[model samples]
Target chain A: MLRIEDLRVEIGGKAVLQNVNLHIPAGETHILFGPNGSGKTSLMLTIMGYSNYKVTRGRITFKGEDITYLPIHERARLGIGVSFQRPPTINGLSLRKMVEICSSDREANVDHLAEQVNLSSFLERDVNANLSGGEIKRSELLQLSAQQPDLVLLDEPESGVDLENIALLGESINALLNRGVKRSGSDVHKGMMQKRSKSALVITHTGHILDYITADRGQVLNNGVMQCSQNAREILKWIREYGYQECMTCTN
Target chain B: MYKLDSNGEVNPKDFSTEAESHDYIEDLAQIDGSDTAEFENVGVETDDSNRSATFILKDLSVVHCKSKQEGIEVLKITEAMDKYDWLKDYMWKDISPEKDIYTQQASESPGEGFFIRAEKGVVSKRPVQTCLHISKEGFAQNVHNIVIVEEGAELHVIAGCSTARHAERGLHIGVSEFYVKKGATLKYTMVHDWGEKIFVRPRTVTHVDEGGVYISNYISMKPVGSLQMNPITYLDGKDSIARFNSVLVAAGGTDMDTGSVVVLGAENARAEIISRAITTGGNIIARGSIIGNVPGVRGHLECKGLILNDGLLHAIPELEAHAPNVEMSHEAAVGKIDQREIEYLMARGLDEDEAISTIVRGFLNVDIEGLPPSLVRKLDRVIADTQDDMM
Candidate 1:
């Protein structure tokens, strides 16, 4: 449901990302493995249309409509939702109101969504104000749940999260994507998997998220180049053995 | 107040302190058209059905004055003085008439102001509302007001001051004094909506006895030629509390110099002063000061201002502690809205303008701003009831 063709991006005259071609079809989740400062966030930010991450070349198309230079809110309205790694605190703007804002024209039961992430008591708190790492993750998921975007871009959901909360976060992510009762590699769940239409691009450096959620494809982005597209498990296993250096050398 | 000296102190002398008298009216309900609209703009309830009392003064005339609630008295200043031999002791008692030219003019002027008082143990079911209106061109209106809350009593006052639409280039000086007895609470809210060319000078003083509480909120949104006021309060008895909150906006050609001062004089007394201001193209000087005079007293001062356009915004917060065991602190911040905050809100599907307005509304602690007239009235009642519950 999303397409990026040779996307090159720059920030303040410095090239941060170059020649990144990727696609995530409907009902599929892709895992992006990258090391620190490897432009994984740059790609996500460029796709979200933040002004600072200037798309210098190539184009992005969502649902077959070009959105290379769309404004942030226009893109958000056009069904592109992103989870921020470190969102800013909005004083006096309560979380309940923020969730409503994210819901836009849709009918959002904010209390019900907040209850799913164990954020019911914090609905009155300011957005992202003094929230722990896990709470922030849950709050982001709650907002996304209200938004119900067709495609979700999650950036490092496992980072800074404790072992206990990561599992709950995985469950929340799965629920958000309508992916109940994981693939399990059995013929019985094939019908259930085909009914899922919400696609996602999940970013992770360590691939620890693979233990909880199922992914259809995986791609390695070393420096600013996209390496190879392969089966999700095979890439994770290879990266676990040889690290990102192998992906960088194999990119050429 | 008008000019500035080399010492950086404000000294006002540009306008004349003289106004012609107007005819007196017995019924304020007959007032309509733009005049009534102007009154509503400043939160004045001309229909006194929901108010404990209503008092209106036009130019130098006490047009209409009445009290409807039990244990409350509202009358013209001179009539009140004539009725109570002890009331003369309350007049000009805390706010000395010799302090400034405005106070001296108010003391000597023939204009009639209002006197409102709540008897002991009487809690007001509705706020006492009053308005000081200017309707003549180049008129200078001087008014002196007094408010008293007896022991174990609670009272709320809404005082609105505005010039009529046809009036031009006038001056308004309001001199007010307040007394809160032991075990009493007084909430005072003032709204100013003067015309574009009027000069406003308000001088106020307050005293709170033991176990008494004082809450004051001042708001000025429209444009004015120049305005300056600094009201001071003394928490003289043990365990007294005082709070001052003010919100102001200085548009193009408007100049505002407003502040509040609190003195915690007794043990265990507390005080807090908060002021928020915004300037689009005019100049704004927001000031707040808190002083702790005795051991175990505490005070805090916060002043924040935002400069939206090419104008001046100066914030001065002062804290003083005279005793070693007293605690006093102050915080002042003046700058423009953060760009990152704007984009953060914009990312949530709101256009740029909508995002900025939301942030601005939040910055002003927007409870009663930009609401429909009916909603404003409803919210006012809701807030009143909520405040009652909390108290």
Candidate 2:
């Protein structure tokens, strides 16, 4: 559903991501494994068409349409949503109005989705103002749920979240991606996979999110370049044993 | 009207004697349709269902003034002064005529303003609507208003001051004094819309007794030539409270300097001042000050401004504590809209223009308590209608 080929990204005249090539087919969830400052979020922002993340070279295709130069709002209109790690606190813009903005025509989903994400009380609050770590995560999920996008980009979903909240967040993500209720499984049923084609690129540091949701593939990005891609669980086990430095030598 | 014992000859011409004066009208029904529309724009309507009392001042005359509610009293200040001998004590008692030239001019030749009072033990359900209107060119309209809320009473006053559309230039000087007795509550709101060449100066003072509450909200969004006002309040008795909220937007060629000061003189007294200003090629000076004179008092001052284009926006916030255990704090910011906030909204599916308008609207939407729904809706409409000018 989403493709980036030979992508070279720069920010403020300095190259941040070089020679990145990846693809997530329809109905698939890809796990992006990276250390700090490894340019994983840069790729996501580049695909989202942020003005500062200049894609100096390469093209991005979503749903077989070239969207390399779309504006942020246009990209959002074309069904791509992002959950920022540190969203800005917008004074006086309540979360309720934010949901209404995200859900253009389907405003009916605001209250129900807010209830599912456990942020109903927060709907009246100003956007992202003085929110705790877990509250920010749930607020983002609530907005994404209202958006109902075809593709989702989650940056470090479990970084600041506690253990129990991370599991609950994973369930929300799974429900968003159309994954089944069976947790700790890396396979989706054929009948279930054929029903929906919601794709996502989830970035994780510890792979603890693997316990609650299924990821079809995992790609290791080390220092501005892609290193390796393989079965999700096997790659996590290997990275846990050896470390990210070992993946720099893996050709597969 | 005051008779001059000095042969009716004035020297050192200020705004009062130098400017042209308009003829007085005996009845408001003789005015034209457009003049009535001008009155309605600033929250004065022909329909009295929404207001308990209505006072209309056209230039140097009180054309129409009456109170429909039995517990409330509304009349011209000059007539009310003669009706009740004690009313003279309330006028110019807290606000000195020697404070400024505007006060001097208003107190010396005081054209007719309103006198509104809430009787003791009465709770008014609807607000008293007052309109101060000038329909003649170069007219210097003087006004001195007195409002008294008796013990255990509640009152709300909504005053709209504006100039007639055809009247190009004018000057308005108003001196207002308010008294809130023990266990009383008063909510006063003023909305102003004027022509580009009008100069306005209003000096005001208020006093609150024990267990009393006072709230004042002022909104002026349209363009004016120049305006200056600084109203002060004194919380004298124990456990008294005061709050001031102002939303100001200055367009090109407009110069506005406005603020408020509150003094907490008794134990457990509290005060808060909040101001929001936006200038699009105009000059604005937003000021706030709080002084604590006793222990167990708290005060906060918030002044925030946004400069949309090439203009000036200055914020001055002052806090002083004279006793131990007095809590006072202030927060002030003056700059352009944060681009990060704009991008964050854009990421949520709003276009650039839409995102900017939303942020600007949010910035001006201060949480003011006790505003009637109609006035709230009118303020919302004004904010929305001026979106293009602010941009």
- Give the best candidate by lDDT: 2
DockQ, all candidates in order: 0.52, 0.71
Model 2 residue runs over 4 Å out of place are A180-195, A248-252, B1-32, B370-374, B377-381, B384-386
Ten residues in sequence with the least summed lDDT for candidate 2 chain B: B3-12
> Can you tell me which runs of candidate 1 are displaced by over 4 Å?
A181-196, A237-252, B1-28, B366-391
lDDT of 1 by residue, B1-391 (tens): 4444454333334555556665565566788667778887777766777788888888877777888898888888888888999987887777777887677777766457789899999998888888899988777787778899999999888888999989877878888889999999998888888878788888889999999999888878777888889999999989999988787777778888899889899989999888878787788989888888889999988888877756799998888878889888888889877776776666667766666666666666643322335434533443333223222
| Chain B TM-score (each prediction, in order) | 0.90, 0.92
Task: Give lDDT: candidate 2, residue A11.
Answer: 95
Candidate 2, residues A1-252, lDDT tens digits: the string is 899999899999999998899999988899999878888888888888888898889989999989999888888888899988888888878999988988878755678888888898999999899998888988988888888888999988887898878888988998788775643346557766665858999988788888888899999888889867888899899889987777767633
Native-interface RMSD of candidate 2: 1.0
Error of 2 at A166 (Å): 2.4
TM-score of 1: 0.89
Per-residue error at A181 for model 2, in Å?
A: 3.1
